[model samples]
Structures are given as structure tokens and as C-alpha cells.
Target: MPGPPILTSPPKASPGDRVAVLSPSFAAPGFAPAVHEQAMARLADLTGLTPVEYPTTRRLGASARDRAADLNSAFADPEMRAVLATIGGEDQITVVPHLDPTLILSDPKPFLGYSDNTNLLCWLWTHGVAGFYGGSTQVHLGPGPHVDEVHARSLRAALLTGERLEVTDPDESEDVGRDWLDPRALHEFGDREATEPWEWAGPPKSVTGRTWGGCIDVLQWILTAGRFPADPSVLSGGILLLETSEELIPATEFGWIVRSLGERGLLEAVDAVVVARPPASSLEVRPTKQACAAHRQEQRDVAIETIGRYNPDAVVVVGVPFGHTRPQWILPYGGSMTVDGVSRRIWADYA
Candidate 1:
């Protein structure tokens, strides 16, 4: 089958434009109003864009159809320039089927999210619409004392200013943050530690391609549900984005998932693979700093070995901060990304 049509970033949002904030997966904002409110205020102050929330945005346990209604309405509205997910959750797979492709295809706009939001992103990709792969009001904007600089830069790049920006290591990260119910969750970050440099593998040549893929766990569900392309060639020459969520699946499991992609011809179809820094700890279980480091290293090794088996020439960069981690760098989904092994740098084009 032919590859997807060339995807384009939606028109950039102006300072005073309205952006929809919807909870298409889980209504995290409803559960933690304080964090959600703070995120809203910060969003307006930072970008000068108005955040318009739909009824289901704050209505927890909303049916998938109801959530899809909000999304459809947002896309159909002439004034809404962009749509943002409150956060990722388990049920977006159900929500995606209810979405009206005509609404999105008619006015394709940037939708920023990751994790479970990958379902929507993948759905949007199928229709040839581009979106950002990271950004969560509940996770990145609300709980921290402030939005991390890397996040702020990429957020603007995705929304207000369409520009090419280097994807950088923030040099520190946290696996998870304070409990949402805790009052301190409003002004504090979770336990954070210094980060290690990203590990580069495969050939030394630089490769640039439009990006595809998302949280590996979510990709599994998408594939099992028959939502992905019947022909892996749709991803031909694209950069594959891969990351695990806070569930902290074992390195072996990650390898298994990649192995499946390899069997399906996806691993060999891509020119490069970009792996986000996987979160190694969660609220219920916090490992020692040393243990966390070891855990990340294990995943890094598995990713390198598995991808190499399928495509030894595929450029691989592991442990870049983009998904399921604090200080996350929101990257382009279905937009241009350059993985330069020679320069040891990465660049994402929000345009």
C-alpha cells in the first residue's frame, strides 16, 4: 500500500485565539479541580490563548460518545484553533471510534497529548492530519511549581509559534508527581534526579523523517484493535516514536512489543527510531535512585538490540525526554524530525 499522504501542521493559533481543552479519555481535571484550574490559568498567562473547556472536560466518567461529541464540536467550531487533552487515560481507544473524521479533516488543528492520547493521534494520522505527541495540562502544567522550560518552549512551538526547535535533554526528570489529592500537589514536583545522556546506536549517519508511533503499550492495543495500518508501509521512511508509560513495563516486555513491530515490517520500514525516556517509578512504588538508573539502562539496551536485529542501519536514540516523564519535550507527531547521530542532536519541526 502507498504511504500516508504528506501531513501538514494546522494553522498556528494566534495570541487571542480560543483553544479547546477536552478530556476525551479520562476527566482528570474533574478529579483535581485545583490542579486543573491552575493549569488553565497558567495556559492563558503563558500563551495568551483562551482555553475553552467542554462539559465533558470536567465531567468524570463521561461516556465515550459524550467525550467524542465535545471533540467533534471543538473541531467544527470556527473559532477554536487547537484542542488539548487534559491528560491520557485507559479508555481513549473507545473514544476514537466515535469521533467524526469530517469535522477534523475539514479543519485539521494541532491536538497535543501522549500516552492514551496516542489512540486519537493515531486516528488523526490515518486521516493525514498532524499533531503534537506530548503535552498534558494535568501532568505538565498543573502539578509543578511552574511549567518546565523545555515544555514551555515546545508547547509554544506546537501552538502559537510554528518553528523548528531542537529537542533537548532537560538534564533532570521525575517518574511521577505528588498525589493529586495532596495539597502540595499544587506547588511541588515529585522526586526528581539528574538525567543521563541519551544513548545513540545504529549507524552514524543522520536521518530525517516524518514521525509516527507512540507509547509502545498503547500501540499494542491499537494494533490488536485493528486501528493501525494493514500495510506497515504507511510508515515507510518515517521516524518511529517509542516510549513506555508510568506503568513501568519490564524491559523484556518492551522488547517483545518491538519484536512484534519488527515482524510486521515496521521496524525495517523506518529510517530511525526515537525512544523517549521511560518512567521507572510510580506513585505506589518508588525505587532507589540507583535502581531507577539501572532500570532505564536495561530498557535502553533492549531497544538497541531489538531494533538492530530488524534494521541494523536504522538510527536509534534512546532516553530522550518526551513521554511519561516530567520536564517532557512535546514532539511532533507526523511532522519532520531529524535524528543526527553524527552531531548527536535532535530537531523537531513544529511547522
Candidate 2:
């Protein structure tokens, strides 16, 4: 595939800039006020910017049309420099169809989100605009003591500046979640362990292409919706970045998603792949750390096997760190990504 050109948009955010935060999918904040408040406060404290909220940002069970309207308003608001989502929800794909394509394309601004927000990121790219994943105030911004250093740095670059984004190896990584009930748990319920160097396992050489993909579960929705997300011609040689959400989809299901991508001819069309650490278990499953890690590794192994079978020529990098992680970095969707398998890092260049 041809290299993706840098997309066009205004410069990054400055201090005191206005940005809109909305819940386009599920309103996660409704159930957890502490996380929601902390995330909002952090945005102001760290960025020196005011976050404007819309009607449904904290309202769960919001209609898809209502969420879509909030998005359009945020994009159309002359004063707002950018738009952000609180966090990703399972049903963002439902909002995609209701959105005004013309309005978004004509008045595009910087957007921040990941996970289910992948629907929006992919949509923006489909409409010829760039989107940023890895900047959810709730996830990156926390009710805990502070934001993760790696995540904060990345959020800064992605929101206010465009620089050489470096991928960092976590000295310690945690696959655990914070407890919403016990304040003590909120202080520190998660576990962290030593992290190995990122593994890059794609082709024999380096290749750069546009970046795409999101939480494997959400991507599945887009694929099943049966709408045209991109021009097939431009997809040739694009780089695919993918990760599973904290919901901890089964290993067989993860493999099935990759196999489906191959079925849809998406795997062969991309030059390389960047996979993130999957979310092992949510409160729903409440699996132990050992079980969570084991499940996640199994899913990763399944994805690796599928990619090998379907797109053997494609370059693949395992564990580059994004999606559902505390210190998530915003990745450029449908932008340039250089996969250096030897170096085990995927360098994403955004417009």
C-alpha cells in the first residue's frame, strides 16, 4: 500500500483552549462518579484547558441519535478546538451510521478516544480526517493519585503538539483494574510486574503504511454492519493496529476475529500489524491476575497464529502498548506507521 499522507487540521491545543467531551457510546461515567470526576479534574490540572461536557456525557442509556448530535455539535462549535470521548463503549458502531458525514468531513477537528471509540476513529478516517486514540480522561485520567507518566506524555503530544512519538517499554505492567467500591482499593488494587521488551515479528524488512484497527470486539461490529468503511484501493499496504478491550474476549473469539479479517481480505491488504495488550477481565469476570494474564497470552497467541496463516508476508509486532492500559498512548488512525520488526517498535507518524 502507498504511504498515508499527513491529514490536514488546525494546530494543536494551547493553554485555556476549549475542548468538548461527550459519551458517544455507553455512558460509563454514570455508574462511577469518582472516575469521571478525577478524569475531568486531571484534564484541567495537567492541560490547563477547560473541558466542556454535553448532555449525555454522564447519562447512561443515551440514545444513539442523541450521542450523534452531541458529536456534530462539538465538531461544528466554532469555539471548540477539538472533541474527546470520555471512554469507549460497545455500541459506537451504532452511532456511526447516524452521523452526518458531510459535517464531520468539512469541519474536522482533533478527536481523542480508543477501544469502542475505534468506530469513530475509523469513521473519521473513512471520511478523510485523522483521529487520535489513547486519550480518554477516565482511562488515562484516573480517580487514583495521578495519571501514568507514559500516558500523560503521550496525551500532551497528541493534543497540543506533534512530535516524534516514542513507544516506551513498561518497566512494570499491570493487567489489573481498580475497585470502584473500596476507596482503599481505589488507592491501589492493581498489580504490576516486570515487562519484557516489545516483540516485533512481521516481515524480514521495515515497512510503513497507514495505521488502522481498534478493540477487536468493536472492529467486529463494524465488519458485521456491512458498510463501506474505506476505499479498497487506498487500503493496500496499510498498517493494522489492533487490541482487545478489558472485557477479555476468549482466545478462540480473538482468533476468529483475525480470521474474519482475512476472510474480508483486510489482512492481506495491510503491510504490518501492531497488537496491544488485551484487557484480560473486567469486574464482570473478576478473574484472578494469574488467570487474566494466562487468558490474555492465549488470546495473543491465537491472534499471532491467525495472522501467520492468513497474512504470512505481513510484518507483525506483539505488545506495543495501547488500548485498555493505564499509560496508553494515542495512536494515529489511518496515518503513517513504520514497523521496524528488528527494533520491535512501531513508529506512527500522524498529520
Candidate 3:
């Protein structure tokens, strides 16, 4: 029931530093070695950092305890400057309780991931170590024909230097991505969709605070498991960043989830809420262009209505390109960010 501690940004990694790329969730690397190899190549090409893999990094059926052990090893290794997830999976929540917080706290290093990896980020935040909330090796680096510039810039800022950088929407985005199992997936980046300008709502003022929240469904799981800080006040004055995953939950379900947060006093505690563009089309369920548009609009309306009911004064922005969508931006899980409703700009201090 204690609130989350004051967060401290971890030391940045420099070029030539050794970074650990592990599978703390599902071992997607084991199933798709070609994709994993490409991702490692891209990581090296983009940042000039050496990637070291752990025992569970490619062990498909590794247990939660084994994954946690890899995390412990990564944190305790002096040569390892940072830890990155090979890719996200469905049950990283199972790995959380097994983590050795003392090891992580003793040598805090930047951890990068999204989706199911939200569990780990929330765990680190509670222990006061800030993490970068995007940059999955498979999704961001492997499947695509080339690395995205937006992602590349944000990754560099998060890992190399501390600087105030503006978060901008990518010129293009894709809800559907390539299939890692297919060889052609390496050459196909999926179709690019025409992007709409970000929609802003609420007061015409700016709010600066530490960023929190992640994939909505994963956050719900975290809350349900009692893994999040029990004290809601810890989120007071902070900025809430929410996004949906490929599951593309219905608008009503999304509203219900937001309502649950409101009932828990989370919605009212934040200064602003930023919603990422939902991925309406998935590999299993590819909707038509018209259907995708309608789905996105309904989600936007539901989010605004739900937030308005809980905290009318909170600033809100939708479609910020930081989710399952392509050309994603890396957000600091517990680092400083400025949300300016007046200027319609968002800046993050990646320190």
C-alpha cells in the first residue's frame, strides 16, 4: 500500500557498450531466429552497441524463474550497460514476482520494451528505476525493411544522451505488420496508412510530470494482479499515456477499462492523458480501410467521454504514435515529460 518511490533515471549507455538482449517473456527469438538476427544487426548498426544474449533469450519454453534469472544476470553484469527485450509476449506478468529487486536497484540500467513488457516497466518504476517503454527487438527492428527514423531518434536520445526532445507523429503508420515466420516478411513492411493529425481536448494549458501507463490491457492485468503501486496518489500530477494493442478491444470494453481506472482515482490524478492510435488491423483480423477508420473514431470518442466524466479539467490528446502501430516513439516510463495543450506539442526529457 505504499506509493511508488521517487524515480531516478538510469545511467545512459554509450557506443561500444555491451547490452543484454533477453527474452523475459516469450522466447520469440527461438521461433524466429532469422528475425532476431536481423534485429540484432539493426541494433548494432543503429547504436554501435554490442548485444549479448542470455540462456533464456532463445529458449522457447523457459520458465518464469529462468527468465527472472536472466534479468538478474543482466542487471548484475558490469559489462552489460542496458537490458532490452527480444520481443514481448503474453505472460511476462508471471515473471515479475521472481525478479531480484536488490540486484536491479544496485545497478539500475535502462530496460526497453512494450506490450507484455509493461509488467517489467511497472516493476522497475515502483523500485524507482526509470525505463524506456518501447523498442522491442522483433517488432521494431526485425520485421521492417529498415529501422524507422522516429524510433531511431528516440532510441538514441534514451540510450546515449539526456536531452529534451519533441514527440512528433510519423508521416506514415501501419496497423498491420509483416509476418516474422515468412521469409518475405523481411522485405515487406506492410502498407502505410494515411495519418490524421492529432486531436486535442481540454484546457489550453501545459502540464509537466513523469510519464506513466502503457498498453491498456497490460496495465489492467498489472492492476488486477496488485503489482502496481497501491497508493493512487503516487500518480497524482503525472501524465498518463495509454494505448491499445493488436487485440483491438471494442470501444465499450475500452471505456469500461478507463472507467475502472476512474473508479480507482487514477484518471482524476493525472494532469494529462495521451492516447496512442489504436491498431485496428491485425494479422488475424484485418479490417477494411473504412472499418478501421470507424473503429479508431469510436475508440477516440469513448476515451474522451470516459476521461471527461472522471476529470474534465485534464488535458487529453489522441493518436501520438506510441503503441502497436508502426514508426513508434519511445516514452520514458518514469522520466520527465511536458504536455502542452496550448502549443499542441509534447516534449520528453530523456535523462
Cα RMSD to the true fold for all candidates: 0.8, 2.4, 1.3
Tell me each candidate's TM-score.
Answer: 0.99, 0.92, 0.98
Candidate 1 lDDT, tens digit per residue, 1-351? Answer: 787567767999999999999998999999999999999999999899999999999998999999999999999998999999999999899998888999988988999999999999999988889999999999999897899999999999999888899988889899999999999999899988899999999989999999999999999999999998789888888899999998889999999999999999999999999999999999987888888888999999999999999999999999999999989999999999999999999999999
lDDT of each: 0.93, 0.76, 0.90
Comparing 2 and 3 on TM-score, the stronger one? 3
Clashing residue pairs found in predicted model 1:
none
Model 2 TM-score on a 0 to 1 scale:
0.92
> How far off is residue 16 in model 2, in Å?
1.4
Least lDDT summed over 10 consecutive residues: which range in candidate 3?
1-10
Report how far residue 288 has shifted in candidate 1, in Å: 1.7
lDDT of 3: 0.90
Q: Pick the candidate with the highest TM-score.
A: 1
- Which residue runs does candidate 1 get wrong by more than 4 Å? none
